[model samples]
Target: MMRASVLLISCVLAVAGCSREPAAPEAPAAVQADPAAVAAELDALLAEWHESELKANPIFATALGDLRYNDQLPDMFSASYRAEQEARERDFLARVQGLDRNALSGQHRLSYDIFIADRESSLAGNRFPAWMLPVNQFGNYGSFMAQLGSGQGLQPFKEVRHYDDFLARIARFPVLNDSAIANMREGIAAGVVQPVPVVEKAIPQFGAHAVDDVEQSVFWGPIRNMPADFPEAERERLTAAYREAIANTLVPAYAKMRDFLRDEYLPKARTGVGQMHLPDGKAWYAHNVRVNTTTDLTPEEIHQFGLEEVARILAEMNAVREQVGFKGDLPAFFEHLGTDDQFYFKTEEEALQAYRDVQQKINPRLEQLFDIFPKADYEVRPVEAFRAASEAGASYQSPSPDGSRPGVFYLNTHNLRAQPNFLVETLSIHEASPGHHFQISIQQEVESLPAFRRFGGYTAYSEGWALYAESLGKEMGLFTDPYQWYGRLSDEQLRAMRLVVDTGLHYYGWDRQQAIDYMLANSSMAESDVIAEVERYIVIPGQALAYKVGQRVIRELRNEAEAELGEKFDVRAFHRQVLVDGALPMGVLQTKIREWIAAEKAKAGA
Candidate 1:
């Protein structure tokens, strides 16, 4: 999943202002006459639309390499701001619709469809009161703000202006915290509060930022590592400023949020894990399923799909057990995989080195399957200490569009046993080389696409591609070890289980323990990992459903293409078609692939 940093920033900035950023000095004049002029007009509109987004959420802007609004923080959660965002989306939708779609072809038509769909989805979401229940275990603004203030997240702290910009941004945290508190209270009044367990998890996250000594805080990171090249006078000035900001403003803001969560919100938080517990929750969950998966598949349909997938994968697991001559059933094999010291690393460095080894093995073979590669580089790093325990086993952060920052695949080494050596190759593929890093970096570097298509994403397309990438192990010649092959199945099983447990928790009214039990019974995941994953589903309903749903569509598309095209099918070209336009909704992706298949067939015949 994409980290909460960009989303949190957008949510916060929604309430800050409604004005568009100042127009570019040589902005295109409004379209007047010709059909060709319509294309230019659409391009100009999208550029303006993207600029407005950056202006509203400066942190998102920074992540995309647009430094124009780095110092700003918008009040994104207020009712007035939401109304403005809604209005702005409506305006953009109207302008996009007014374009001459009949006059456009190829990429221009695809852009038009995607732009319209994106705006409509945004407008449709206003029906749900997501603003009221903002803070949750997985992605509360409190945690995201701390990450930004720590100077290691998207907010830059390099030059003096970068430092000053962050100081300006951090100064606004108290206001954002006040808004979050107010929103939570409103959630309580409206019967839209988070689950009790999820809210409790966030309390500790807030306290991590609310430190007693400013110097000991995560926010003290930039100051501790200040550049030696800085002038002594400027260094002293920033030091004093940072100390004051952390001690007085940032720390107090976090304490207020922590205290509110503990004292006020926690008491009123709903005990039920499902969204069905909230007012209009049933419909809300259905909407979220549609949004995340970009499909009309209902929870019941998805639940059944999960059941079928789990059974199929379990049968494969049994095959692996028999191959290894394990003298036991499937559950016993799971136990062995989880407990055997041979499958685990003894130290953090060992685990890190194992992942590095996987990278070396896979890098050389990537060109055989994919012709287009991302220019932006990537690296492997340990998950930051503060959030490591609660974080997923691995996640990827995309590279900066300008290539200043390499995409990082953060491995969680909080528990060495959970970082099993068997899982290293699959995890590396999913989070780095053929997964997020490849998809996202290619999107950012594709200058032909509009800004939204480049940076924007459909959850299903992105996550599904990663899951599909994991399935390429044998073909790529890396999963030669039986344990490594089992690792791929285990990873696939996790996505399959997400289909079952996420829907179970939200749709079937299964409690947290019920979700946890289902995961434990179905997969070989460590108990701590299972608990974290379950809590993640509880807090972020419908998101987990995207992985399997997306992967299924992409894999199906590839199979159909290979069958129809026969010897004419080029895996390299097939991959390029899917990724060249960045992430599309599954339907759009299918259309694009079908078109490519037809064109390939025509070429072969000619």
Candidate 2:
């Protein structure tokens, strides 16, 4: 949710008669705002904004384990609501940019910078009509609700209140879903709509929920998993309420949307797969590039950089191929890795277990890499069946701040071939243990930082860090097997390909198949994985660019640190410095590491 703004409070004494008003107290001498005073004000602004954000999107709040707003689902797509959010963003930018950041230092200064940047980015992005085309194959409110409605998501099913909370939200789903229709209509009038293919992908997903039987709906999951301690009457009563709600409200909502998309939206959906076809698309994609990568690098620069990285990584892959004595070219080696029976699991259980196996392997290796660890634990789970078809290969969900929930690494087992054996260790390291779960758990656990920094993310920093973590596999001695090393290269190749394919789609006007073919030719990825990845870049532009862009900057910083610090360059210390602060923009991150290196060098002289 975009944060709202608050004005500083004013207090004035007014209990005096007009003529008998006491002489004003002597004016204080003019001086800079005290550092602590500025920090307090900035902290106040951030705290209030975070609270407002939670309230604005109650589901977001609920996902973070804040139960106060679980029952509310605001009309986020309505024009009035959008205008109000834009106003709030402008107001926050005014208040935060008004702060005397020069007087502040350390965490306070960083907070001020991040807050101002966030507000500015949000406001700048308001020019783009992202709200119009909200739902896609990837996700939107509809699919997200399914995740929450199911018992497995962050929403608790422990008590009666929880059920009621979800019931209220469910009743409001029609409002939100209809608003999605209204927004798409508005988009249609404006010549802005999701690509034809991605919209078609969402049909079955929403259609799956439009069932006649209330028991069959995902919303019935909590009722099925109800606690044993509940009295029979309460169960019966709650079950009836759920039945009525699901049958009348929720299923009807899904059906309405499924029909609308099939009958209404699809005919009007744009044929061009890239944002460049939209109004002001060039500048719009530029904004995405600037924001996602957190650098001024253009689409062209990122595309070329991706090409370079792909070449470099492929060279290393060829070395691994030769070492393994594979009598084939790199593409042939990629084919072998893709089709060979030894490279894939036979069943979903084996696929999931492969990910689970990585945790045990890395547990002992972590001590060699770093001193810091998150207090919150993480679990490996499969992506739920309903939306898994469109979900990414693997993703990590952060633990609740209250520690009620641990971080989750959701591996998509929709296609077992996509979940290959060789890639297990690399993917696990990227999405689980020292990748997202590790970085995010460390971030949320840092209580001294403001709530926004703890929970908010900069994509380039976080995803870049995760991509960088994949490289650490070799450093930690985990990439012993040549096949595992190839897996690392393959995964890195995916990020590298993203930098190319994302730019090619949005900036170069490449069609969907062109992007897909490019990825297939470049990496050892399954065709299914390649298609999903390409479509992901289509729906969400410039996001894929972040992984390679972020990883490059971070790796450059590390290389520079190792070079300058020499014997003093402890990898553990370097890891601490990077992870200690939550995710930072690539530029801020570079400056930070340089300062760390200078400080460490000063220590050598001292």
Candidate 3:
């Protein structure tokens, strides 16, 4: 919920005195606003947006269920394409300006603000040509195409035509790669190359898909597991086309791109970890910080805030360490958790089974806390073997809007040592249960919400809510085991430490290894996990700051309510108010909570 505009005591006094003196003859009332008209305008704008956007980024459109442009892949790295996307955003902003926001209700107004702000932010970002460096190892179109063509990802596999269309899409890989190479060359000239580490890490990932025979590539997933209902003739044709497309196009393209990065791009890549280190680094990072955090807080301010938060969470962690009968200090306990086989699963299957077990165990207990829950069912699945090492310990993929698929909680079992028994409860809560599952699925099911707000999200609000749910593990009665409770503390500490480490590396000149060492020393983290996390920070700066900072504000808001309302506070109602209007800025969330508190107090007075 967007916060109500702040009300001053002087404004209240002014209104009270004005009400007393209101004896003048009333002028003719202005035209009454129609909610339906406002909605019609919104609908028109949304359709126009979908059309304009799909025409510009057809791949993204297909990913999001818009199939009209299914066969046409945009030259995403083209200069003209970038300019056109910016123009589209400006037009959307202008078109929506004609609508009377005050005529709409609260939710519609919020949708308007979020949409406008996002576009305006995108426009602000247009100054930087991120399109020029589109195909990094982290998530390049090269790899994504394989995933799409593999018949197992987002591309529909129900129909054989779907399979044929995907193969046609895969055939365009070399054109896309040529465009990407041209774009990166431009980046080199502009001094806008990605960090050396990102490029270095990406080379092997590309090589993984670049195989001796494309016919036997990961993209063969569909060919291997064709729908049993398909006619044998159709299936055979698809399998042959898929094999030819993969072997001829995808495999060669991946090898070409991988070799280019290794032999051409890697040596030219800048050693700097930050956008600030690039030619226009300072401006680039500033725009990114604002966009990612959705606040105007400077990197400098966030850095300082993170430092303070690290100090605070450190004290809490130390207190937990002492309670657990650790003979050594907090650092020793961290090392113990990192290295001990006793804390780890014996195999990858065991680790995945543990998460599935958590799914069954927590569902019944969740009802005790949430009066409202997402109707979408979710299942626990292991990370695909290809990307597991690079992935987070556990991550969630939200359900399709139509509910054909349940939300998926992907657990990474790449290195089983990183999958600790102690942290399972906290991980489940953060990735599933009252964490992402609650916040995301609820927003999607909100019928009154506009399409964008229902589908789109802010990292701070989304990740912050998940971290906050981790704190609720004890409240919901799941952290009964001391080791599990310690796991909760450890995970909480990791987020708290992210506040420090992310800001440290990006803003304060801390080395990559420095960030990794700090996390390993402070929390029970495996070195592999620490390396992946530090690299994640290097590529995507300021994102790690969201979880803890957002969580802190939310907790402060709740504490204020509990204190002010005393015995009258309703936890469920408070959560409903936070979630019901969808995600909002931290400032907006604060305002909404204050409004709820005042309304509750007024009701008590009556």
Candidate 4:
């Protein structure tokens, strides 16, 4: 199984984001120093940065198929490790600052800016006690490790040595689990713990792995699915080793964590849902707002933006209702759409098939809009039963860069009633084609970019691009059905509501119930899904804000480009410009698009 130590590092690296200013005019095509020399230095620095990261967090390396550190697990929550990371970031920032920004141009300049911002953001985030409050319902290490061990995730078990590598990693789980307990204990003392409701949900998640039988354990998945090519004696020996590891090492580690969470952690977990309750929580949430959205907009500003968007989207929803002749008010229409049997699937297979059908319908039409398609293929799968109840309606996982593993679009089939027909088109568009899979795979396949640029992401850019991709359904001749169009509006409405409820929970001190009530009033989402989403926002402050914020910026940029370029506007080129360089901060993205617009205009005049 992959260690939580690496999972934490990956999350930190992933959760990891910039600035406000009108973008400056593109620099003159002049070089103050040898561009090659500057590029070489930048390359060296990025290599050093990646090497240090791999050493500090090896599990992340394994996830990327870098197997050199597969046998190691670092205690990333340790104070000393955090201090080391902070100092390293500071040193890199200094080295980057010493570079001549004026001497770098084009992609090199962009890389310089992104690298500096990344380091600065990393250092700035250290003020919050994120380590102390480690585990949550949304992103607990226990669940992630289970996924890894289930023979379905990133951990490979093809060879006997691979089995040995996993055993070595599994043996370290107890130490990591103990560290989590220690960290949560410190969080309790510091009054910086997860919400009681969220933590309560996690207790069962931990218990799911604490099975009494070795054969029944999720960790025994590798043994159950062992390669058939293995010699009989070797297979038997490996099976015995795995069984012992599960019975002695894995089960005990899970039991320890489950008991610690139930008997000790729950009593101390805070009832308050907002980040505001913790020391410096207001500032911490504010920082997260900036980081996640890659914007300077304050919570109050985002709340108001959400309100305006909600009102506007509701107006569109009303139009859809009138078009469909629903013969009721907007709220009534929401209820009808949600509860009406016609809109829902009868079985899990029907739901899964619906998504597969969407894939077939949409694939041939992609060429009409996109000139640059991802080489990586993707598959649609049902979200695993263990974590599906709490997972989102749909999500995308990027493909491995080498194409060894196809990207996965996990549709939550836990509740068939929640899987409405209208959602199939928009959900497929957003999570699969021309959405995350399209954007992320293309980024990963771009061999010219540095590893950090290829792998690193800004949530706003990624989620925003996915959300923006939803808007393309109309252009693509999908969403022709009024109800499907309403589904698009509903998806957008959820994002708009997030702008309100996420800020409402973390900034304005709204309770979990308040957020739920507001969502129930605003959209057609089921109460259970609404509750799960609200709790998700509660635990993961500032994350939900990315979707709408990112989409809004991209839309504004596209509108600006279309207006400025008029006859010159090319959708294919515009998309290529937005996606070609991988995930960038919103501001940086805007700057690049503006520069592209200028260059295109210049070409038109020429």
What clash pairs does model 2 have?
A: none
Off by over 4 Å in 4: 1-33
- Scored by Cα lDDT, where does model 1 land? 0.83
For TM-score, candidate 2 versus 3, the one ahead is: 2
lDDT of 1 by residue, 440-538 (tens): 999999999999778888888889999999998888988888888888999999999999998998889999998899999998899999988999888
lDDT of 4 by residue, 1-606 (tens): 000010011112211212323245567984356767877898888888888887887877777778888877677777877888888889888997787665576777777777777776777788888999778887788888888788887777888888888888888878888888899999889888888898888888888877888888888889999999999998999899888888888888878888888898889888779999889989999888888888778999999999999999999999999998889898899889888999999988899899999999999998888899898899988887778878778887777788888888888899877778889999999999889889989998998898878878888888899999999998999999998998999999999999999999999999999999999998899998898899889887888998998899999999999999999899988999999999888777877788889899999999
Give a tens-digit lDDT track for model 3, residues 1-606. 110111111111211232123334446786655888987888778767856766786765665566677777766777777778777888888888667655665556656655666676667777777776776654567667766766656677777777777766776668878888998888888888888878888888788888776556788888787889999889778878877777788888888889989999999988767656766767777666665565667777877776776677677777777877889987887777777778989988888888889888888887666778888888888877666656677888776666776887888888888778998999998988888877888888887776666666777788888989888887788988878888887787778777777777766778777888888777778888888888877776667777876787789998999999999998888888888877776666776788889999999889
Task: Compute each candidate's TM-score over C-alphas.
Answer: 0.94, 0.94, 0.91, 0.94
**After superposition, which runs of candidate 1 have C-alpha atoms over 4 Å from their true positions?**
3-33
lDDT of each: 0.83, 0.84, 0.75, 0.83
The backbone clash count of each candidate, in order, is: 5, 0, 2, 0
- The Cα RMSD in angstroms, rounded to one decimal, for candidate 2 relative to the true structure is 7.0
